[model samples]
Target: MATRDDGAGAWYHRGQVCCTNRKLDEALACYDKALELSPDNPLLWRRKGFALIKAGRYAEATVCFDRALAIDPDDATAWQRRGYALACMGRKEGAVACFDQALARDPEHILAWQSRGWLLGTLCRYDEAAACYETVLRIDPDRGSAAWHRERMRERRDLAALASEVREAERFMEVPACIREVVRERDYGNAELARAVLREMVGQAERPAVQHR
Candidate 1:
């Protein structure tokens, strides 16, 4: 029979060592043994959740985070881990909510902020996503990835606006009633010229209302 640790200290030390050695399964087992002895220890549960995540058991990791959060609702680390696990599981909304909770607890939490930005980007909230990336840049000026993401978000916004303009141009090109008779009666000397005139008219009509600054 595997004996459980009566004191949380020994189990925590062993678990940390196992984790440091990259033996995630053994680390998780040690954490489990610790939790079995002290079910109310939020830190132990949080450690277990992290080890489970390292083991690629994201859903189970989320459950362990939930257990830790239930024990101490103000645990920001648990909330952050839960958010990461949710994001890994493709639950963007849930991940956003969890990240929000983590940020509420610790406003300076960089990972939570970055995660929120990523989730916002995933949801097509480009402006908000850009804001989040900017926040990260403010905290760490050398954050190259955040800068790259911010640029991509700006490009996506510009591209979406351009695409909308193109669609509007297509809609405007539907043969106008006033031009229908003229188009039917007049034969241009060159097919290319007729197509060029039509394209010019469509472009004029579909000019986007907003100008990019």
Candidate 2:
């Protein structure tokens, strides 16, 4: 047992080092070795899940995260990682539920909050997404990326509103007589000359209609 534990520790350390170096395959190999020695270590399982996620093996990563969560139900990191893997698998609803679980375990988990916000954005829940980002900003005022994301969400909402307003205004907009003429003459004359004529027509159109007293 002692020898097996030592091997597990060594493999875990090697896996962590490889993960830090972004060598996902090597990290996975070490994690596999560690799991062989200590199959019940939740931490090792979580590490393997993260490495699989980095390697773009999201389905396998989800299983690993689920295994870790089964071993340690209160593991907020595992929940958050599972949420990410679910999101990558296009299971948005499942991802959101996992994120909620992570937040329930640790409300101050910034990554969980961020992931929830991103999922909300994907679902087109801009208001909720903005609120989530605002919460993140409140928790970490130095989070420049969160601030930027909040601003972008606001911009998207505002642009959508502006577009609706433009559509409504278009119902009242009338093509000016000169613009109509320019369009009619465009094919028969130089485009520049047509534009010049259109500009003069606009000037005349803007002038109040002359009325003899």
Candidate 3:
């Protein structure tokens, strides 16, 4: 690390101050100055990437993150930030992969879990998404966003599962009446004792489907 006496350190501090003040362009300038003095500094590269992301220069931010990762592959925060940049650019699959990389290095990374959950939800992988949010809630029980999203994902997953079961039931009903009778008699009850079990199943499933809408 550069000492306070070094020009690079001074510049890096200035960049941090600017970033804290939301002066992203000025922060980028200071980071560039620091990088000029210490081009091999991965921290400087990552800081620049964060400034670019704040500016909505996602493509440039990704390039800076790429440079940072090339310098140090084990940086979980850099990987997570890179995923965020990719997500901003609409590269969702790429973002998810980057989040996976971050989690591989640090399973307790809350932001990575949250971001992955959001992406999975967008992709309609509700069960997996809900699992991610469940992990987030376990790690930080006060995370209201994660808690809210978890419930939403669970509802969606349940609806999807129920719909699939209903479809299977419909298909089963379409089978030969002989087969249906056998199934009904074996699993449900004899016709003398059964009260239209298959119809009841379909009706229950369809009720939820209607409520989901």
Give the best candidate by lDDT.
Answer: 3
Residue by residue across 56-145, what tens digits does model 3's lDDT show? 999999999999999999999899999999998999999999999999999999999999998898888998999999999999999999
Top TM-score: which candidate number?
Answer: 2
Candidate ranking (TM-score, best to worst): 2, 1, 3
RMSD of 1: 10.5
Model-by-model lDDT, in order?
0.79, 0.82, 0.83
Identify the runs in model 3 with alpha carbons over 4 angstroms from their true place: 1-5, 159-213
Count of residue pairs whose backbone atoms collide, per candidate: 0, 0, 0
Model 2 poorest ten-residue lDDT run: 182-191
Question: Once all C-alphas are superposed, what RMSD does model 2 give against the true structure?
Answer: 9.6
Return the TM-score for candidate 2, rounded to 2 decimals. 0.77
TM-scores of the candidates are: 0.74, 0.77, 0.73
Show the colliding residue pairs in model 2: none
RMSD vs true structure, all candidates: 10.5, 9.6, 10.8
lDDT of 1: 0.79
Of 2 and 3, the candidate ranking higher by TM-score = 2
Model 2 lDDT, residue 109, Cα: 93
